[model samples]
Target: VFFHNALPFVGFGFLDNAIMIAAGTQIELSIGVVLGISTMAAAALGNLVSDLAGLGLAGYVEALASRLGLSIPDLTPKQADMWQTRLSAHLGKAIGVTIGCILGMFPLLFFGDEEEKLEEKN
Candidate 1:
């Protein structure tokens, strides 16, 4: 059950971070320069885009998670409401999202801080 609860959140965190990073980097490089916005502002806009994408893609993420062969345990309503069960689910989601966010940072390696380069050139 813990694994079950965690699985979808992993996908959510991964996509959220990955999209935010990639989109933010691009926006910072392109639109930010043209509009003279700060990097943080670009990042905020990128987060907005990522959040919108998350809303649209949530169902797909859930479907992918379901395909991973992890299923929720068959529990009675009372069993499902137990404190231990709820705790496990929460802990699972926390750990899973942490792991997935770390994994999603791979895009940073490729992005390589274009801002640093611009600063150095100036």
Candidate 2:
């Protein structure tokens, strides 16, 4: 149950991982720390940041697209690198945490108990 509660945090980090992977970060799940409590923490943090930043990122990109009359998905190599660096620099931990949470969540969901526990009623 203790570990079971931690799944969402792990799931929260997927966006961060995607951004980092685009930015060329090396992910080593084979390492010890990658799956430790740190990973869980990272995932929660990522979720936190993504929840907040995702909104802004979406709006910001939309605004940029409107202002520049450019396609958001068509970022140049330098633009991609710059954005990746910026996002990573500010949101690295959160991103890593998000990634960890996403990957971490699967096991919990698949293996978690389907039965519900009822509390005592007076």
Candidate 3:
């Protein structure tokens, strides 16, 4: 679960770093907005994929354990529900980051002084 939760953060950090190096001070506000939106979308989609894969793997592991006659602890219904929720949230974050990074790379439109102003307002 720890690893699962950490995946999106790691992915987003990488995306952010890539964007910063690619754009730097040359980025504009419009480009930043576009990048932010795109990265978010992509991160969300990617997170969903990751969540599904993790769930699938967990299911497989449980099944294998059962087949091997090993005693596996059953997850509480609430725990399962919470896990799903967290997975969805992580996925959404990942999509956001992916979209943001891609759009952020546009120097003329995204990484501008106006963006800093907007950010300050937030």
Q: What overall lDDT goes with each candidate model?
A: 0.89, 0.41, 0.50
Give the number of the best model, judged by TM-score: 1
Tens-digit lDDT track of model 2 for 1-122 = 11222232233354444443322211212221355434445445545555665555555543543565433244467875786655644464455455664664443343223212111210
- For candidate 3, lDDT tens digit of each residue in 1-122? 43333334444544454445433332333443557555455445445554555555545544543565544335576875796766765675576556645653554454466557767976
Model 1 TM-score on a 0 to 1 scale = 0.94
Q: Best candidate per lDDT, number?
A: 1
Tell me, what's the RMSD of every candidate?
1.2, 16.1, 12.5
lDDT against true structure, model 3: 0.50
What C-alpha lDDT does candidate 2 achieve relative to the native structure? Answer: 0.41
Per-residue CA lDDT of model 1 for 4-108, tens digit only, reads: 978888888899999999999899888988899898999999999999999998899889988888777999999999999999999999998898888888899
**In candidate 1, which residue pairs get closer than 3 Å at backbone N, Cα or C atoms, i.e. clash?**
none
Sort every candidate by TM-score, greatest first: 1, 3, 2
What TM-scores do the predictions have? 0.94, 0.27, 0.28
Name the runs in model 3 displaced over 4 angstroms: 1-19, 22-81, 108-122
| TM-score, model 2 to reference | 0.27
